[model samples]
Target: MSESKSAKSGGTAGSRAGGTEGAATSARIGVLKTYKLFVGGKFPRSESGRVYEVTDSKGNWLANPPLASRKDARDAVVAARKAVGGWSGATAYNRGQILYRIAEMLEGRREQFIGEVAAGEGLSRAKAAGRVDAAVDRWVWYAGWADKIAQVAGGANPVAGPFFNLSSPEPTGVVAVLAPRRCSFLGLVSVLAPVIVTGNTAVLVPSEERPLPALSLSEVLATSDLPGGVVNVLSGRASELGTPLAAHQDVNAIDLAGAGPELARDLEIAAADNLKRVVRPAPDREPDWRGDPGTARMLPFLETKTVWHPVGS
Candidate 1:
């Protein structure tokens, strides 16, 4: 009788454990997210009506980011051009305020970025958070430069002809930037903040394989008091969009930080059609975006206009 009772008790315990395990396994699955492109301060589906699956470093499906086409790149350039006069001509103080606002928005959304970075790079949560923090800090660094870069890059030139010669740096107009393939967020911000902080408008091509953080960042920018069309971001194949942007007469410059040697060489050749200033990465490698980005990044996108006035009337 005692054996019979013990067997019943054991069976009951096993059944309870199984039920608990089944309940734990039944937790709801999360809804996946869809990432779109950001252009002219708005989120829009790619005109091509196509999206490419973005996967984690482990090859797990993450999200589908829009695959921007040449038409998208052209539209981005048009938007950038429309924003140039106002954005580039805005007072330095105003530009600084807008850049600081981007940092502010980023701070509020840090946790989301931390998660995205961790998944994209297969990094530990702590390391990913550190990267996110660094990206925000980079924006802060560039914010301070907005009002100061002109002073450091331009000044008076001594002239012998009884005239005052003044050299001043001005924005180089619309620049198309190819974001680095690795470290999506940090590299993107590093390339982008420097380009726009100096009063230039930009059309940025985010890393094709990992574009979630870049898409999210567009949300922050849209609400961060940055003027519409000042910064347009596209997610797609670099090779497809890059060629048209380089050849386009409207684009004033090209940043080849993410480009390989072959593509960079081809784009550089095409950019020559309009005599566009080209910023190429080191041979056979992407730029070390994590390293110090000195004034070199800013200098190429600026034009030095020297003005002279007769001293004696």
Candidate 2:
């Protein structure tokens, strides 16, 4: 590639030479747009046929992902519900292996991701790289949990008489997650792993503004042999998808976030219809979020089930 082309395509869509920032999207520069939603192990447009432009932090056109409609949301919920039983039935050790592969894929793509975020989110090279690295590390942390959460949250129970009782953490069937409005990669993985680690199938909607990495994460999930539909993801307005899942009879729980108060209210009210377990709102959430969605997020989505049987004389 020539020096000019190389400069335009190197990393960020803008240059910081001589401490001056300039747009790299001259008509002559080559660019591409992404336009599809990852669903049911395939990429397709909204059934209602809508599309929206996504811009990099530089405002250069990045892609036009499908503007998933309510029908699309219903379809994704069907996918999640379909896979819940098989996913929950998988042995914990096997589940751990597949989740660990996600960590491996993320580690391999660390630099590319750092560069993407650096260019896409306008963070300095160092900060972007750090965020990418942290995101990968977070995946590894949760990978370990796939085989261990039960140890931490489940155990043998003491019975009052000559009877036996055992309490164990189990998948709550299908889950719906409204990813944080900030911190795309880390928060996405944090929210997803815990849901699936317990054997729950999740239908995750990425933050509208920063859906690229979420789609990329879906790519990794696809390759990792997570049973198709075990962890479905969509990139569109959360409001467009949130309401249906919060109230969907098949979805056992919903993790809420993205935007502000109005979105929260809609989710809470929708969830009330089913008494669906819901994750509450956070302060100033973003599309580039990072935190343990397990303790705080997963706990609420999960329920404690105790089995009691009597050994009588």
Candidate 3:
């Protein structure tokens, strides 16, 4: 009987050991993800080699995004300028296809964006999901505009002379965009979609505090058939990057939607050095991004060009 009891006790201890080992295997730690900047169709670390901690709305540590420097901003501008010719020359229908593909990719990664938006904006999961949907929809909306904008904005003009006078809108070349501080994702799509749909390349400065979503967006763009440097994202202080971009001699326009009152004034002054087209923010308050985005946002970055040809030539 004593021998039997000893065997049973040994079996019980072995069973407990197996259970402990299984628990340990199940409780393994997860690997963390390191985010990088998207530049010229590639992911690159900042030239400054500096990173700042990005926290959630509740002050919880999220991740460290690169602290973009003046050099980084200039590099982005170079990338944007390099891409201008090919991107602007592409047919509008092709541009629309690429933009729609971006929407499809964004929809595929909807859950991930929902989480990031929730954490960054301090919204509930449902609300964050809603914002993500809106952002995706915004891309589709802009894609549709790609082929139609020309029809709506351009036409034949009657002239007294025996010549055909045609007026059409053309891209204003490289544009420097400041992504809004609030509505990080939706506002970003709102401003950025308009610029690129018309065949203009952009050097975008995402929201300083909530840049994770924008960084993730770069991943989508890289795979969405967009040419290298068509959209370069630099994550850092807007004021730091916007100042250089506004004054950039090569940049064709400046969108100050994300700048504060004081910074906006300064950027406008700098933009004057090159007579860059400026999209000034509202004087009273931030415009509601959820409202219908009319053609107002797209008009500033477009220049009307008139072509005259002899009728009988």
Candidate 4:
């Protein structure tokens, strides 16, 4: 009878311990991450204090990204303009190192980016992993081009006169890039890397529907030795932000990769007001982000300057 009583007591204690463990597990809560805009090398809430719902391709609630206003767009321009001189004046080799560093940092965070990309674009984990890998490789490719673009794009020109004429490429100051709406991560990297790799600071608008991956990239940029304001990412309606950016006199050029036909038409007209260089989108179809990027995107943001010197001098 005593043994029977002791066994009952032991069973009761075990049951009580199991219940406590379950309660503790139930009490644990997850910490949610807050998304914000990346401007001037800092993460800031939108000046307008507005946010819009972001959903995955399946329309599942993801998170609310900042709804950048005209004021926010202007602020990003200010930040990009401020960074232009310093970033543009850096040696090509130094820029290459920084670009390479971004790739290194991105590789370290590969799994995180893969998850974000998968959710944002509604892709399988394997496909998203491929996109993330491509994005990292793109950065490394541009890094190699940083110090060598000048060699391929510029050189001494043969002249009949007794003077030497040399032409070289220079950054076009601040550029506004509309990141592609599809292939969110890879496409964003494709448009963004070329703009900044060549010394131009950028005000970028990520794919509106799939902006989480892009916002996450801002964190990578912050830690990758890239100067703040060198690449300002505004997560919001492209139409709202692109309007002010297109009309801003200080923005030296605009890439319409992410803009729709109607919006692209309007932005092109607005960009004409200040004679800004424009990279117009293809009228029919978007270029395959997975294909060879070539130098076409980089050329639009570069200006050629010719210098003449007497042969004797």
**Number of the predicted model whose TM-score against the real structure is largest:** 4
RMSD values, in order shown? 9.4, 4.3, 10.0, 9.4
**Model 2, global lDDT:** 0.73
lDDT of 1 by residue, 65-121 (tens): 899999999899999999999999999999999999999999998877877777777
| Strongest candidate by lDDT | 4
Ranking by TM-score: 4, 3, 1, 2
Report clash pairs, candidate 1. Answer: none
TM-scores of all candidate predictions against the true structure: 0.90, 0.87, 0.91, 0.91
Write down the lDDT of every candidate, Cα atoms only.
0.85, 0.73, 0.86, 0.87
For all candidates, the clash counts are 0, 11, 0, 1
Q: Report the C-alpha lDDT of model 2 over 41-131, residue by residue, as the tens digit.
A: 7777789888887767778665667788878889998888888878899998898888888789888766556655665666776887778
Q: What is the per-residue lDDT of model 3 for residues 19-76, given as tens digits with 9 covering 90 to 100?
A: 3433454553333456778889999999999999887788867777889899998998
Residue 270, candidate 2: Cα error in Å is 1.0
* Model 1 lowest lDDT segment of ten: 6-15
For candidate 4, the 10 contiguous residues with the lowest summed lDDT are 6-15
Which residue pairs in model 4 clash with each other?
Answer: 41-228
> Tens-digit lDDT track for model 4 on 172-209?
99999999988799999999999999999999999998
